[model samples]
Each structure stands twice: as C-alpha cells, then as structure tokens.
Target chain A: MGRWEPNATDRLVVAALELFETNGYENTTVIGIAERAGLTKSTFFRHFQDKREVLFGRSSLADVLAEGIAKAPADAEPLEAVACALELLAQDVFTPERRDFIARRQAVVATHPELREREALKGLGLIAAMTGALERRGLPALTARVTAELGALALELAYTRWGSASRDFTEVAREALDEVRSAAPAR
Target chain B: MGRWEPNATDRLVVAALELFETNGYENTTVIGIAERAGLTKSTFFRHFQDKREVLFGRSSLADVLAEGIAKAPADAEPLEAVACALELLAQDVFTPERRDFIARRQAVVATHPELREREALKGLGLIAAMTGALERRGLPALTARVTAELGALALELAYTRWGSASRDFTEVAREALDEVRSAAPAR
Candidate 1:
C-alpha cells in the first residue's frame, strides 16, 4: 500500500549495529557496515556521515521530544506535562523493532568512555531544552530547570529498565513513573 | 599559633589543575603534576590513583551532603530539608580554595567527553543516595527520586552560576532555590 525505496536507512542501521556488537565499535568502519548491508560506500555515506553516526543517529529524537513537551496543554502541571510529553515520545520515537536496536546501541555506548560522554551531552541538551519550555510557561528558571532534570532522570530510569531483555518499554515506563510519584513527600 | 601540617593532597590537586589549564588535560601527566607540587610519584599516587582523580576528587562532598539531608529535622518539607542539607554542605565541604578549584575542574571536564560522563555518573550516584534517604523518611519511591533529582538539578544550576567569575556559591544557590519556588504552580 505504501511506496518504500527498500528502506536503505534501516538496512544501514541494522548492519551497523550487528557489526558494532560483533567487531567492536572502534573496529567497524562505514565501508564494512555498507558491505554487510549489501550496499555501496556511497549508499552508506548517503544515509550516514560516518561510523559514529550509525549508532548515535537518532539525535533528532531530542528535538521531537522537546517540541512535544513545549506543546503540551498549558493547564497541565509541570510534571504531568513532562510525562505526557515522554509518553508521546515513546509512541512516536520508539518502535518495537527499533527498541532492540536502541538497547544494543546504549550497551555499546555505555562500554565506551567517549560514547558515554557524547550520550551525557545529548541528555544535558534535552534537559536544557525542556527547561526552556517550562520557563516559557511562566515557571521560574530554577523551578523549570529542576522539573526538566527530574523528568530526564525518570526517563533515564525507565529507559534503562525497559531496555532490559525481560521487560516491555511501555509497562516499564509506567512503573518507573509510578515509582517516582510514590517516592514524593506527602503534601 | 597554627599547628597544621601542609595537606599534600590539596597541593597535588592545585598543581594538577594549574598544569591542566596551562598544558591541556591530556598533555599533563601525573609525574609532572607531582613534580611541580614538590611531591614524588609515590606521594601523588598516595593522594590520587590517576590524573583523572585530580579532577574528580569531590565525591566526599556528595557523601556529606547526603548525610546532612538524611539528618535534617523531621518536620521540614522535602525541598526545605534539601536546602538545609545543601547549606550545611556548603559550609563543611566547599571551602573557598575548593570552590575555585572546582570551577576550574568543571571547565576542563566540560571540554572533554570522557570527563563529562564521569561527572554525570557521579551526579547520578549522589542522587540515588539522596533518594534512599528520602524514602527512609516515608516519602514514596517515585517522589523521593523526583525530589532528589530536583535537588541535584537546582544544585547544578546554582553551582554553575556561582562557579563563574562573578558570583558566590551560597548566594547563587539561594537565588536558584527561590526561583524554583516561584516557578511552582499555585497550590
């Protein structure tokens, strides 16, 4: 029903992840990934700029998540707004096929110091953007920043738990959020 | 009238920071830093295991801050307890010399990806410890985690601003907390 041009990008990503897991991230080249995927070097470069981008290519998710948060209903509380934003992000940005891929990507990144630093920077950038959105909603700067950070922490915990082989992402995220709420001081 | 032997650890840290700023973090070795501080390789190793530790030797402050939060008066609200804990930490953990040293260390870490990840992991560990403290106070798990994350966020923002050339740490922290309160939705 839909016109798809062989989904070259997905093919590239899958090949890259496989090569990274088997041969180590540093040892896998763009040419090797392309060859494994049955594509040419030009096709690989057409989809990704370099080897690092093969694993870290979804940085665009940050912008999409930030926009979702910024556009959340104004009537919602800061925490609720952030949660809704994340839920929407989970549905839109994290598909089941991509989920396993992401888990492997995270594992690879976690093992490499340089990749971990890049991941940290990416997380910081998302939190900063969310903070800005909250500030625009008449929240004070520090409050906005705290709310954003809290949201990020919750997301991180949920992602880590969900990425485990035994769990599903949605259920894990819901449980994680509930855990966060239950831990709060009574009003 | 003072009967204090010079702190060999502090001297090493200072020398390391100076060398890192002058010669770049990767270029400055442990032996060079120790020599500049009039200490030997053994003395440097006694104080710090590696060059990286010189920039990351502040985990003790996290322990003190967590302990202070755990021991806050029973009647204080979670956020209030956290603020009080931070105040105590500022007095006991962050001396004037340490403040300047930390600021320099932050600049160096910010520029290097590996150092940044180490900082993130350190921050995550501190937040987890604080969350456990809040849970022990009967706060729900989620709430405790959120509150701890918020506290860390506030501290990070305050510290970054204070660590700048123009501001004091305590003053910036107080201001940041006030901003957080003001940003909260009307109850």
Candidate 2:
C-alpha cells in the first residue's frame, strides 16, 4: 500500500501558507518558510523561485480545464463546451479535501493588494487559455474570447459559492451556470 | 458660435500620453509632462496626484453606469438592467473625440504590467459600483456580483474591439452584448 508522504514542493507550500497566515505576508521571509518546512534554502529555491510562487504555482486545474475543452465532443455548442470543460476540472481537480488549502491560499492573496493583482493576472491567464482552446475548436476569435470569458466568470462565481463549505464544487458550478443562463435574456 | 478649447486636465492628459509614448512610461517625469503641456508643475499637481493618475484618474463613466442601473425600471431583470446601464454609458460617456484619448490610454496601460494591474483594479471598481447598483435594485448579492462581472467583461471586450478607431463605441458595445447573449445556451 502507498503511504502518504509530502514532497518538497507540498511541504514548502504548506509551510509558506502557515507562516504567511501567522506572521503576515510582508513579515514572512523565504528563510523562515524554508526553515519551517525542514528543508534547506537551496531546496526551496529548487521548488519555487520566490515566496509568491507558493501561491501562484501552476496547478493541474489549468491543465485539466484546457485539456477537457480541447478533447470535448466537436459538435458541442461553444458555451456548453466551455461548461463541460469547467465541470471536468471541478470533478477532477478541485476535490473536497483540497478545500482547506484553496481557502488558505485565497485568504493569503486577499491580504495584500499586490498579491490580489497577481491573482487577477492568474484569472486572466485562465481566460486566455480557455479562449485559445475555443479558438482551436473552430470558434471565431471574438466569439471564442467572449465565450471563454463567460466560462471563466462562471468558474469564479462557483468557486465563491463553494467557499462556504456546504456543498460539492461541481454542484456549485452547475448551479452557477444555471444562474448565469437565467440572468441573461433568452436568445 | 462656440469655440473649442482644451482645458488644463485635458492638456495634461494629452501631454502625459505623448511623453509616455515618446519617452517610455518609466523615464517620463511629471515635470516633463507638465512642461510639454505648457503648464507649471504645481498646476499638474493640482490636477493629478501622480503620473499614473494621468491615465487612471476617475471619470464619470462609473457614476453614470451605476446611476443608470439604479434608475432602471423596477421590473427589469438584473442582467437586462446591467446591459441597459452599459448602453446608457456608451451613449453618454464615450463621445467621438474621447475615443482617441481612451485608445491612447489603453495603449499606454498595455505597455506596462503594473499599469495593467491598475487598469484591472479600475475595472473591478466599475464592477463593484454596478453590483452595488444592482443590490440597490434588490438583486441578491451573488447574483448582482456575477451580473456586474459579466457586464464588465462585455465592456472590456467591446472596448478592446472599439480601439481600432473605426466604429462608434456604442455600436461596438451593442455588438459585444449580442455576442455574449448568443453564446449562452438557449434555455
């Protein structure tokens, strides 16, 4: 049987979040995070370039979303296709157990205006990725861009709702999509 | 007959754009911008807190948009109300001559990452205003927030498309809204 073992990267991320919450982001240092993680500074550097990367590091969520969109049925409508992709990520990437980490990460990012901007950039990156995937699926550029943005919008709203810790993320996402569809005028 | 005259604020904005484009944003000093505008440094300070404010200064667009939403007919749906507000701002706030300044401001903001974040924050501010307006109209908090965000997304996309300097901003915005509505699944 496989035993649970935290890798260097996971250890660093956990340690960084703990220190950031306890000492504040500005007061927390790279050296302190590394020491708390029981790893050398070089090991920390090998895993992340700086303290910010602990929060901003590439996660499988982006990959899963992009891959899901790219591999969706070719005949699916654009927005439906985007929703399918997001649902796939919700199922595969954002599990119930990861809730604590995601919550802590959001709290840390919320504490600083600069970090919030970086978080915004990350959101923009997801939209851009989804846009590119839709474009590759033969959607027109403008349509793809708008549809991707809407999909990202749904994802964000769902994440916010799911933050309450009462329901599954996928269920929240499905309800969020329904809310968006209801909000708009029928075509 | 009425005569055309550029006021101090307008002169400073034009001068700041010129200096930012010509001398690069980092190298362009406030004094240089004021000198180019044929205004004293004190006059520049009277208008803007700093060089960044030259591009990021508050305008009437947010006020008009929020007011439009707040004043929409009581029976109007939340998203429809948001769209109407955007349409109103498009008609009132984005005049033909203002188009040039907006385009230049966007270009300057695009060249620098920091400025882009500031620009994004400005966008967030608009969304917050719109959300508050929707809340005033009795929409639920999450629904208002999501609807406002979608409106902001449409505005950003339309603004980007309108930067080409050919069509009226209102027309571009209308088309952008149409694109979003059409992209959603027909329920």
Candidate 3:
C-alpha cells in the first residue's frame, strides 16, 4: 500500500462530493463534509468557506486552461488554437478518475438553481479571458468573442459527453472538435 | 400623465434590481427590497423564498425560452431553429424595460463568483432543454448539444451587447446571429 496521505483539502472535497451525490446538495452541510472527511470543522473552514465552495474550489483548473491557451502555436488559426488549448486542458485537468466526480458535481449543481447560475458566470469569465488572448493575437473583438464562445461551448459539450461515460477527456475533446469541423461548411 | 400600477412581482424585481445595483447583492436585504417595492416582508415571502430569490425569481424565463424552441418551424435546420427560437424569446419575453433590470441583475451576478456559477447552471439547464428539443427534430445527441450550446452562447453575447446600450434586443439578437453565420465557413 502507498504511504501517501491525502491532504485535508482533498479529503474535504472527496467527502463533500460524496455527501452531495449521496444525500443532497441542500442537505449537505460544512460540518457533515468535515466529519465525513475525518477532519475538524475548523480544518474544513480553513480549506473552504462552506459546502458550496467545496464543489467549486477546483477553480485552479481555469488558470491551467488559460495557460494552455496562451501556449498554443502562434501560427494556429483562432479556432485551431482554441481547440488545441481545450485538448491540452482536457488531458491535464479531467483525468479518468475525476470523470465520475465531475458528473456528480454537475448533477449536484444542476439540482440547485443558485449553483447553476454561478456556474454560468464562471464560464463567461473563462470565455472573456480566452477572448482577451485571442485579441492579443490580432483577432477582432467580434471574431475573438465568437471563437472563444465556440471553443468554450465545444469544451462544455465534450466534458458532458466524457462525464457521461468512462472515456478519456482528451480523446473525447479531440473527437468533439473533429465533429465540429466536419459539420462546418466546407472551405 | 397615465396612471400606472406595477404588480407585486414586478415591483419586487425592479426594487431588488435597483438595490442590487446600488448597494450590492450581499448588502441588500429582503426587508429593504420589500419596503422599496411598497410591500411588506410577508408579501415578498409570498412571492419568493428569500432575499436571493428577489433577483432570481424569473426561473420561468427558461420555460418561456424552451417553449419558443418547441414551437420552432418544422422545416427549419437545427441552428436556424435555435436562432429563430432565441429571437422569438427576445421579442416575446424580454421587453425593453425588463432589459434594464436584466442588465443590473447580470452585473450583480457577475460581481459574485457563487452567483456566477449559479447563472452558468441555469444556462446549462436551458441549453439541455434546447438540446432535447433539437433531438426531437432528429438531431443526434452530440450535434444537438453543440448546436444548442452555440445558440445559447450567441444569445448571451447578443444579450450582453444589447443590455449595455439602448439597442433593441430582438434586432441585436438577429444581428448577432448574422455575425455567427458570417463567421462560419460558407455553405
């Protein structure tokens, strides 16, 4: 057996996701999450403000995705760059073991109307960041916005598909991008 | 001058939006919103669950949008149907006065990370419903999802642009759709 011990933050997220999936989002409290994680309420508070934060604390992934977007080849077209960035993000962020957890997290967020609204805002922020990057590459405002929106939409669709199954996210994302390309009008 | 009396729900929404814009979301209280609307806290409770619901009580707008999707023309392609449905929704559901309220509500939601997430979830739910409607018209699951997502993104972009200025939403939405179409490879 591995001697690695899970950190308090990791344990809290796992426990919270489980409680959120098993019991219910509204019913799951910070105390319950902390106890389930085998930690004190103070420890949980140290990691997150409340139950809602536990599900959303994974926001670091957004920064990683942004970094991937920044690293796309300079010669790539706007759409191609976005697709490549999403592919990289899928490979790095949504590991196989995280698929089920993501699905459950989505389900929990879906069940709560407030949480759903928050999710949309987060998506819009990410798109805005991507738009800035595209603009820096000399794309026009409208074109950049559209490209970022398309990329975000494709990533969302691919994530949903991957979350619904056991497929690797990188593969699913690439396939989704291919599907989009094939469906587009021929050049 | 014409005598005008706003309904309780309308008054509440307007009051809440104003307060959210000026005082900020977390700082605005239910009692203050009720008082500004010329209603009691009890009356506010009769219409909504709590302070947060004052800004978010229009969940029925999703149903209205969904109905538009369901009522789209039978011969229309998936993207065309989605664009038309969103256009119809803008005309039928979101009026000029209501657009102001929506702008303020969006601003407040944007300022709060949690509220942003909740808004994302709501958009996702709307897109899912739109996807189901497209699927009923013979679109495959992935295609339906992508079309619906693209449509939703287009609508959001148009709404943001329209809400920022004095432009008509229906006109802006149609123009935004044209922009999306123009960006696509020639058919």
lDDT agreement with native, every candidate: 0.74, 0.80, 0.76
How do the residues B141-163 of candidate 1 rate in per-residue lDDT, one tens digit apiece? 66677777777767777778767
Rank ordering of all candidates by TM-score, starting from the highest: 2, 3, 1
CA lDDT, candidate 1, residue B70: 78
The superposed Cα distance between candidate 2 and the true structure at residue A139, in angstroms, equals 2.3
Flag regions of model 3 displaced more than 4 Å. Answer: A1-6, A14-38, A95-129, A160-168, A183-187, B1-6, B21-24, B96-121, B164-167, B184-187
Per-residue alpha-carbon lDDT of candidate 1 for residues A1-187, written as tens digits (9 for 90 to 100): 2233387788888898888789888888888998888888888777777777776675475676677677888897888777776777777876566677678888888877767756776777778788887888887676677667767777788877767646555566666656665554443
Best by the TM-score measure:
2
- Candidate 2 residue lDDT tens string, B44-115: 888889989888784766898898898788999876787788778777877777787788888899999778
User: Could you list the CA RMSD of all candidates, in the order they appear?
Assistant: 6.1, 5.4, 5.3
DockQ, candidate no. 1: 0.28
lDDT of 3 by residue, B1-187 (tens): 2223459888898898888789888898899998999888888888889877666766465666667777788888777787777777777766786777677777888987656656666677778788888888887776677677667777877878877878777788777777775665322
- The TM-scores of all predictions, comma-separated, are 0.71, 0.83, 0.76
> Each model's DockQ?
0.28, 0.31, 0.29
| Candidate 3 CAPRI category | acceptable
Stretches of candidate 2 exceeding 4 Å from the true structure: A1-6, A40-46, A58-60, B1-9, B34-50, B77-80, B87-92
